[model samples]
Target: MLAACGSADDSAEQPQNQDGETEQQTADQGGKADQEATFPVTETDAVGNEITLEKQPEKIVSMVPSNTEILFAVGAGKAVVAGSDFDDYPEEAQKLEKIGGQEFNVEKIVGLQPDVVFAHESALGVGEEGLQQLRDAGLTVFVVKNATDFDETYGTIQQIGKLTGYSAEAEEIVSGMQDKVDEIKEKAEAVTDKKKVFVETSPAPDIYTPGSGTFMQQFLDIIHGENVAADQQGWVMMDPEEIVNRNPDVIMVMYDYIDTAVEDVYSREGFDAVTAIKEKAVIQVDENITSRTGPRLAEGLEAVAKAVYPEIFGEAEQDEEDQAA
Candidate 1:
C-alpha cells in the first residue's frame, strides 16, 4: 500500500498559571471542550524539533494526504491554504492549491506564506533537505509522527485540534470514531467462522503485503479474519507458490494503479487452486480508506468487513434472506 501514514503528538500545551490551575469541561461546553489549551502551543515534532506556534494558524499547508485529512477532520479545513498532489478527500481539498507530489514545491509554499506547514516522518528519509529549506525561509514546519494504529491516529487529530484552537471539535471527532469502532466490534464478534485473508498492495511482478506490526493486521483481527502474512514483518514480498500452499479463503487487492488488478489475480497460473479463487471471494478494496490512518479509519474498517464477510456486511446476506422467503 502507498499508505505510508504519519501523524502528530497528543501532548498539546495548555495555559500555565502560577498555580497551574486547570479544569476539565463538560460535553455541554459546545462539543467536548476536553483539553483546553492556551495560545503559543509548543510541542516536539516527529524529527525532535521543538516547533512552537505563537497563535492559531490562520493559513496552513499539508505535505501529505494523511495530514491533510487530519487537518480537515479537526475543523481546520477552512484554514488550509494548500495540500499535496494526492489530496482528494472532502471535495474541498481537491480545490486547494496543489503542492508537488513526492517532491514538494517549496517555492509555491513559500509564496503562499502559510502560518504553519504540516509534514510527515515517512517523507523525511528523502525530503529532509526540502523541509529544512522551508525552515530557512522563517516558516514554522511541524513534522507529524508516523502513525500505524487507531490510538495514534486519534492522538494526531487531537494534537492538531489543540494547535489550531479547535480542541472541542477534535475531541468530538475522536469520540465519534470510538463509538463507530465499538459498533463495528459488536457486529464483528457475532461471526462464528473465522476466514483467512490475503491482501496484496501490488499485483504480479512485485507484490507487497503488510505483515505483523501494521494496522491492516489489526483490522483483520477486528473483523474475525486471519491474515496469511501475519508471520512476516512490515511490507514483504511473498512467493506465489507459498500463497497457493497457504490457500487463503479471501484475496484482497488494495491498489487500483492498474485497471485489471482483480482480473489479473484470477488469471494467475497457480491461484486457481486457492480456496478464495474457487469460491470467487477475491475482492478489490478502496486503498485510500483502508490505508490512510485518519478520521475515516472506522469507515475503512467497515469497508474491510464488507469485503471479507460480504454475507454479513453487504447485500449477500440480504439476497439470501429474500431467496429463502
Candidate 2:
C-alpha cells in the first residue's frame, strides 16, 4: 500500500474557536494570512508549505474526479465553483464549470478565481508546474494523495472532513463504510481458497491492469480475491502469455467497456480458453464508483464481494429491488 510517512504531533490537537473554525496553523514567524501554513487538513495532503486561506474557502475548484466526489460528499458541493472534465458522477458536478482535464490548463483554472484549488497527487507528473504556478499566484493549491489501499482511502475521507468543517459528517460516512468493510471481511475470513483476478480498463490497444499499489487491489483483497498482478507496482501492461500463466479466476470489466469485451473477448481464439473466460466469470463494475477513492467506494466493494461470493451478496440484490420498489 502507498502509505503516508509523516507523523502528526499528538500534542497539537486544537479545538474549534467560538466561531466553529479551528485556528489555521501557519509556517511564517509573523503569522500573516498572506503566507502559507501547514495546518492538519486531512489524511492525504496537509497544506504542505506556507499557504494560508483568506478564510475557510468558499469557492473551491476540484481538479480531479475523486476530489470532486469528496468535495460533494462532505457537504461542500455548494462551495465547488469549478471542476475537471471527469467530474460527472453526482450529476450536480456536471453543472459546474469545467477547467480542462488532468493534463492541466492553468488559464482555465485561474480564470475561475477559486479560493481553494484541489489537485491530485497523481497530477504531479503532468500538472505539477501548473499547480506550482497557481500556488505562486497565491491561490491555495491542495493536493489529494492517490491512496493504494483501504486505510489510505479512510484517511482521505477523514482529512477532507476536517478541512471542510464536516468532521462529524465525514466520520459518520467513514464509520458506515468501515462497518460494511468489517462485515465483508468477517464473512470471508473462513474462505480457504482465494482466487486471483485481473481488472481490464477501457480505451483499448493500450490495455492496463491495476498493480500492487492501487485502490482496485484493496477492493480485490476485501472480497478474498488476490490481484494476479499484485507483484507489479502501479498500472502495468500485461502480455497474453502472462495472463495465461497467472490464470486469474475472475476478470473485471469497467462498465464503459462492457460492450468491448462481450464481442472482442469471445472473438479472440486463444483468450477463450482462459479460466475466467471459460467460466464466464467476467464482471462489470461502475468505473465512477470503483476507480475513484471517494464515499461511493463502499458501494464498489459490495460489487466486488458479490462477484467473488454471489451467495453472500444475495441480500444486495434484494436491497436493490427494495430501493427500486
Candidate 3:
C-alpha cells in the first residue's frame, strides 16, 4: 500500500507576503507568453478548451464540491476564500463563504475579488454568462476536466498539483493512493469467488448502477467485485425486475439510506432472486465519496474494498478511519 510519508514539507515553498498572507505571483508576460511562468495546468476542459493560468492564485473560489475537495487536499484550502453550495465535506470547508451551487453565483463570486476561480465542467455550462463576466473583470478562470475513470482522475490530481505549485505533494498523494489500490488488487487476486454487486444511486429505492466505463465500475474492480449492470453507460435507471433476474451477490445503497433501513431490492414485491437480499449482504457507502472523483477518492476506494471483502480489508479500513480522525 502507498504509505503516507511526511518526508518533504511544502509549507515553506508557499509564498508569504510582508503581512504574512499568501501572495499570487504577478503575470509577468502578456497573453500566451505569460502562460509559461504560470501554474503548470495542462489538460483540456470538457468543452475541449485548453486552460492555463498565469500563476498560482492566492485567492481562489471553488465552484464544484469535488474541485473544492481537490483544492483542500493539495494544501491550497487556505487559498480558497469561497465555495459552491454543495461543498460540505471536510469540516473546514463548510466554514467558507457560500457562492451558490454548481450553478455558481457570479455576482457573489465577483464581489469576493478572487484571483482565480476553479469550476467543474457542469458549472461552466450552467453559469457561463456569469463566469464570463468574472473573466471580463480580470479574474482568471480555470475549468478542469471531469474525469470518468481512474487514470483520468489520477491525472486530474496531478494536473491540479501542478497548477497549485505542489507537484511533489500531489505526486506523493497520488502514488500513495496508487499503492493502496495495488494492494487491494493483489489481495483480491486470491479470492476465487468475486461478488457481483448492484449499486443504487438514488434515495427513492431505484435500481441504478454505474456503467462499465464509469469511475464507479473502476472502484468496484479495485474491490474485486463485478458490477451486474456493467453493460450500460454512466448511471442507468434499471428496473427492479431486471435486478431480480441478475440476482447480484451484493447490493450497495447510499450510506444515508443505511440509517433509513431502506432496500431497493426488498421493496420490489415477489422479487427475491437476488442472493444479496437473501444473505443480507447489502452495504451502504457514502454518496459523496462514490459520486465525486477527487483527492480523498482513496477513501472511497477503501470504503468499497471494506464493503466487498471485509475480511481482508477490515483492518486497513479501520486504520484509514483512525488516521482521518
Candidate 4:
C-alpha cells in the first residue's frame, strides 16, 4: 500500500526562498532518477518466463497459502489486495478478496486488477488454464516453485521481497529463521542417545507417513531422530503390523484439523507393545507450521526437537489451547 509513498516525501519538502528552492529542485530530480533506476524489475520466475514489474506493485494477489504467509511476514501485507481461499494465516488475510481454491477464479482475479499475481508451481496441474487466462487478460503472473527445504524457502522469500519492494524486511525474517535453525543444529550435537521416531500424517486403517524424499524427513535428520519410515520413499502408507514391528520410541501425530488424533493412536489394535505407546511418547504437531515451508518452519523444527528430547532442546512451546484441543 505504501509502495508509491517514497516519491511523496521529496515533493513535501518546501523551500523558504528562491536559493533554497533551486537546491531542493535539484535534490528532488536526483531522488527521482534513483527511484527510476531501481524499478522496472525483470527476473526469471519458477517458470522460465522473465516477469517484469515496471514499478513497485501497489496491489498484489497471492495464489498459495505459503506465499500469502511470506507476503505478510515481509511487511508487504498491506499490498496484498486478494489471496486464495485457503489463505488463513495472519488473520487479516482471511478478509482479503478470496479467489477459488485448487482452481483459481480467473475472471475475479483479473477483475481485481492486481499489479502482480503470485502463483506457485505446485498448482500448475490444476490451475495452468486459469493462470493463462489471467495472462491473456494482461495480468502480471509469476509462478513460485514449491520449496522442499529451508534453503529453497529462504530464496523464495527473498525473491518475493525483491519483487514486492520489501527486500530488507525479508532479509531480517530469513536471518532470524537461519539463526534459529543453526541454534537447533548446534544444540542437537549434544545428543548422545538418539531415539527412533515415527511420524504419521493420516491415522487409523489408512496410515500415511513421510519418508526419504520429503521435508518431514529432513526435519527428523535435523533433530537427530531416526525415521523408521526412511526405507520407504515419499509419503507412503505403512501397514499397522509394520509400524508395530519398527517399534519407534517417539510417535508424532501430524494432523491438527481432526480431533481424537492422539487417542486414536493410543488405542490402535496391537500397538500396546510399541515402545512409543508403552512409554506414552505420542505427540501431536501442527501441520500448518511444520509443513508450510514458510517463515514459521524453523519454529516448527524447534518445537519438534523439543518434543523429541526436552532435556536437550527444552519443553515443546505449544499453546495451551492447541495442546488441549
Candidate 5:
C-alpha cells in the first residue's frame, strides 16, 4: 500500500503580519518556497496521487488500524491525536479520540485540526467523498493500500516514517522484521515434510479463506507449509466439501470478533472426518496479528510457523532445559 501527505493550501485566507504583508503574500514572496526546500518530501499514495508535505505534521489522525500501529511503532505516537474506532494497539491508541471507521466523521476530523490523516484504500469504496471533503478542507490525507504481502507492509512502514519524520526508526523496524523472517525461513528449510494447512478467516456456512496471491499464502510459503487454498486466488468462499476433500494436516481459524473456536471447526459436519479434526490440530490464531499489515506482522508469521511446525519451533523451553543440563 502507498501513503502520501498533502501540502497546505496556498490560497487560504491569512491575516497580515507586523511587516504589513498577508501570510499568503509572505508565503508567495519566498517563505513558502523556502519551507518546501526544508521539507522536500513527496510520495504517491495508493490512488496514484502525488502528495507533498511542506512541514512535519504535529497533529495527526489515523483512519486505518495498520497505519495507527505503524505510527506508534516508529515513535510518532505522540503526533497521533486521533484514531479509527478499531485502533486498539499500543494500549495508548485506544485512548485517542475516535473519528470514525469506514464511514469517517468529516466534521469531527476537521474539528481535530490534524495536520495529516492516514487512511486506507478501501475508503475509496464508500469513504471517498468524505476523504475528498477532508482534502477540500485543506487537510493533508494519506491513503494506504491494502498490502497483500510483507514487502508492501514494509513499504507502507517506510512511507509512514517519511511522512512522520520517523524514517530512521522505520528502517530499523523493517530491518529487524527482515532478520526475524530470515531466521524463520532458515529454520523452516530443515523440515523434510511440510504440512498442508487450511486457514479459515471466517466462520462456517459462510466460510472464507485467503487463497493464492495473498499475504496468508506468502506466509505459508515462508514457513514451508502448504496452503490448501493455494489453487484459489484471493479471498474466496470455500465449500466445506472442498475443504474436507483437501484433508489438511492443520486448520487455522482466524477470527476473534465472533464466538468461533477450534472445537467449532472440529465439530462441523464432515469436518470430523478431516485429518486435522481427528488429530485435534485445529488452531485458533489472533486475527489482528495474522491479518493486519503492520509492524506486528512478524509476530503473526512466527505464530503461524509455530502452529504449523510445533515440533521445530515449540521446543524452545525444552531446548533451554537441555542446554542448562
Candidate 6:
C-alpha cells in the first residue's frame, strides 16, 4: 500500500506569456471572476457526496498525493497552500506546507483557511471525521476516487480540473495520456512472445503482490506480459512456496524505500529454481511511478515496458554507441 506523507513550502510561480501576464495573473485578473459567473456548480464526489461550489476557490489544500498531482497538473499549483506529507512530486509540491499524513491535522488545515480541500476516497478509512469537521467549518471538500485503472485516473483528472477552473488543461492532459497509452498498446500487440511476470510489493517473510483488477495487472497486460498471480484478486500475501510453484519468467520488485535488494530475491533458497532467478531477470521499479495514479503514469508505463522487454523498448543502439564514444 502507498504510504501517506506530508509537504511543506510555498506555491509554485506561474509561467508568464509575452504579454507579461502569468496564468495565475490572468486567473486573478478575470478568469476566476468569469468562473464565478457560472457558479453554484454542483458535482458528485467519489464517496457519493454532493459538492456545490458558489465561487472559484483561491486557496486549496490537497490531502492525498494523487490529488496533489492532479491539482498541479491542471494549472492549480499556485492555488494549493498545503498538501499531505506524502506529496513529493513535480518539485513544486515539495514546497507546500505539510498538513500531516494519513491522519490529517484538522486544526492546522482549518487554520490555513483554504476555500477548498481535496481528499481521497481511501482517506475515509481514517480521516472521515476530520473531513466532516472541515465540512462543519463550512468549507468545501471534494473526495477523489481511488483509481484502479488508467480510465478512472483520467476521470479523476477531469473532475479535479472542473473543480479547479482548469477544465481545458485537464482535457488536454487526458488526451496526451490517451495517445501515449494507445501507442503503448499498439507496440504491445506486435509482441509474439509474452513473458509471465511476478510483481512483488513487499519483501520476503510476508510477501505481497498485486493480482487481477489491480493496476499492476493492467500494466502487465498493456506490455504483453502475463501476471503470475492473475488467478488471485487484489493485493494478496503469497507464501514463498506458492511463488516457487508458479515460477515466473521475470520478477519485478516494487519497493525502493526499503533496504530490500534484488540479490535477496535471487538468493532466496527455493527461488533460485525459478526461471527469473536462474536468468537474473529480477528488476526493480520505482514505487511512485508504478503506484501513483497521476500525470507521470505514462512515464511509468514506458518504464515497465522497457523493464519487461529491454530489447524492444529499451534505449536505442545508436544512443548506446554514442555514449560509448
Across 1-325, the per-residue lDDT of candidate 3 in tens digits comes to 0111111000011232233432222111111212333454555655676767556667889877777776666556767899866677566678899877634566777788887777666444446677667778777777767777667778877777677665555565677667767887887777678888888776444556677877888888777788998888776988877777888887877547345644644655755667888877777776677667776676677777777777777843475467457
Candidate 4 structure lDDT: 0.77
Model 4 per-residue lDDT at 167: 68
Q: In model 5, what is the error at residue 320, expressed in angstroms?
A: 18
Model 2: per-residue Cα lDDT at residue 175: 75
Alpha-carbon lDDT of model 2: 0.65
Summarize candidate 2's per-residue lDDT along 272-301 as a digit string, tens digits.
Answer: 768888887776655666767777677778
Model 4, range 24-141, lDDT digits (tens) per residue?
2322232222233357788788889999999888789888788887877766677788887777776767888977676567777788999999988777766677787788889999
Candidate 1, residues 249-324, lDDT tens digits: the string is 9999988889999899999998999999999988887778777777777777887887889877874334334424
Q: Is candidate 1 or candidate 3 better by lDDT?
A: 1
Off by over 4 Å in 2: 1-47, 202-205, 255-258, 315-325
Instruction: TM-score each candidate.
Output: 0.85, 0.79, 0.80, 0.86, 0.84, 0.86
Tens-digit lDDT track of model 6 for 178-267: 887899888888789998899998888999998998888889989999999999998999999999999998888877766666878988
How big is the positional error of residue 251 in model 3, measured in Å on the Cα after superposition? 0.3
lDDT of 3 at 318: 70
Worst 10 residues of 2 by lDDT: 3-12
Candidate 4, which ten residues in sequence have the lowest lDDT sum?
2-11
TM-score of 6: 0.86
